[model samples]
Target: MAKITGETRLENVLVYMANMGRELIVADRCTVWLIDEAKQEVYTTVAHGVREIRIPAGTGLVGHAIASGEPIIIEDAYLDPRHNPDNDRKTGYVSKSIITIPFRNNDGTVIGAYQAINKMTETAKFTSKDMELLSLAASYAGKSLESVMLHQEIVDTQREIIATMGEIGEMRSKETGNHVKRVAEYSYVLALALGLSPKEAELLRTVSPMHDIGKVGIPDAVLNKPGKLTDEEYEIIKSHTRIGRQLLKGSRRELLRAASIVAEQHHEKWDGGGYPNGLKGEEIHVYGRITAVADVFDALSAERVYKAAWPLERIERLFREERGKHFDPAVVDAFFAKLPQLLDIRERLTDKG
Candidate 1:
């Protein structure tokens, strides 16, 4: 007996059934057709022996079996009015008998129809035992396809959530652009250049966008102010680091934890002159260091309410000048080396607004 196992491919299942226990199994051709509810049509997926055939629901024995969700056994193809002989003519193989069974999902919904044609040797017809075996095989195929679809749905939902959170952070900054995407891409490139593993690079790509999430705590007036910030206003703005840390503290998720570190230390300078705790050098989290370079690069090149956009030349100059003073020297070096590719990404992803 042929067994249907978890994670088995549909083609393998079909081949297994063709070879299992039946003496003249090699003489038959197998075909699978999936029903399209919206189109009211049946499409062929796999066809052997039979060239190809498609019929509407209730048009032929195959269609009738699918519509009625039952097994069909045709012993004399030429005598059956519902038999479509075009397929046999196309494949140059006469059909003596065919057994088709409706494949049902776990919810009892008919997912497709499976058919085995032209039983070999004696005039033996398809039996109840054959239908029962094929039905079991179809069930396993349905479950495997369902599992794959469910997994895709989960991945799509995660992507939507991440995109929504990034939008929220971008809206809080009063920066009318794709600042989040640009910074995230920049951080990813920088992480790769710094020799981090691929997984770490991807983590930084996603978490870097949340570095300014604490800006949500700042007042709208200060956050969207058009003029230069005063010392007092600047001090309040600087507190966003701690505010971000506080907001994200105690989370067990590694992404959120990394976001918290980035929020707190992205503004900290290489020389220890930057805000909140004034921690410097290797004291800063690597995520924070990478985000700092990315954030500053984007901010400099992007036009904001308070600052005009800097030319690429000037941006490169500032990075080189501030290597050890404002930015990590290693990160800065990597940024310059990969500047061309970064510029291409920035241009490709630039927001029209």
Candidate 2:
């Protein structure tokens, strides 16, 4: 047995299969076609004298092997109804006898097909030995392809989980009306506008939405109050920020950590008059400051059960009036600078439902 090294395994496998076909007096133009089940197509992976080709399953001889999961031997190409002449025409190679064998994975699932065309010295008819060798090669190819597909499935599942969590957050706050999503988008845009790196912008986008996640713990009466609250009620309402922080605390994940900061300090004012520790100017986390501006802007513009939607002009005026008092000066400027783009997003994402 020959020692199989890492770098040349694929090349060696294909060469070995080609030589086996030659020794069996089959075709000189041997090729291997791997089936991508997800795509429902047969793609040539290794070709000796033939140009690699891709064909829909069940369309040609190779397709027959894939569809039937059985080997096929065509001693006369012109006479066999399963033979496809387009391949030879496209590649400008004359066709003769052809042999195709199914490649199955370890679990006996067909992963691809191997095809050999035009024998070098004899008719291109597959012998039992040719079938045996090609089947073995196909098994190796199939297993490799399945592993890649399984890994992609895991990645796709993780993405689905994240999306589901975002949807759950949106469902919880009927008053906010997609507030989580809007804040995420607004924070993302603001971060980019403030000259943060792209990676930081994405992190902020995901983390900022959890800013009001603490509202989940607040009572319906406090969260959905339609009128002005009494001092005591307002104080209870203020506890949400703290609750949000507590809920997200101690996560090692950077996004979750950022969420904890945003949840805790977003309510803190620029002049040191806000609640939940009243951290002064530049004393609060930058994420908290950024989310403060985004949350306020969205809250003002979006209609909630508690308040009517402010007009675009009113929202703009409010931002200007509260610049140094409510929002960080630099963040306020970034907000106004990107106002037009924000309005476009608002228009596109109007809460129709």
* Candidate that would win on lDDT: 1
In candidate 1, stretches whose alpha carbon ends up further than 4 angstroms from where it belongs are 1-159
Please list the residue runs of candidate 2 whose C-alpha ends up more than 4 Å from where it truly belongs after superposition. Answer: 1-170
lDDT of 1: 0.77
TM-score of each: 0.62, 0.59
Worst 10 residues of 2 by lDDT: 1-10
TM-score, cand. 1: 0.62
Clashes in predicted model 2: 0
Distance (Å) between predicted and true CA of 126, model 1?
A: 18
Candidate 2: tens digits of C-alpha lDDT, residues 1-353? 13221223454555554555454454667776777778788787777766667788787888887899888876678888888788678877787777787867668878766687765555346566666766665565556545544654654554354334545555565743467677778888899999999878987886776777676777778666778888988888788888878887996756567778888999999999887998889998778888999889888888777788898888889889988898898899999999888777777766775
RMSD of each: 7.6, 9.0
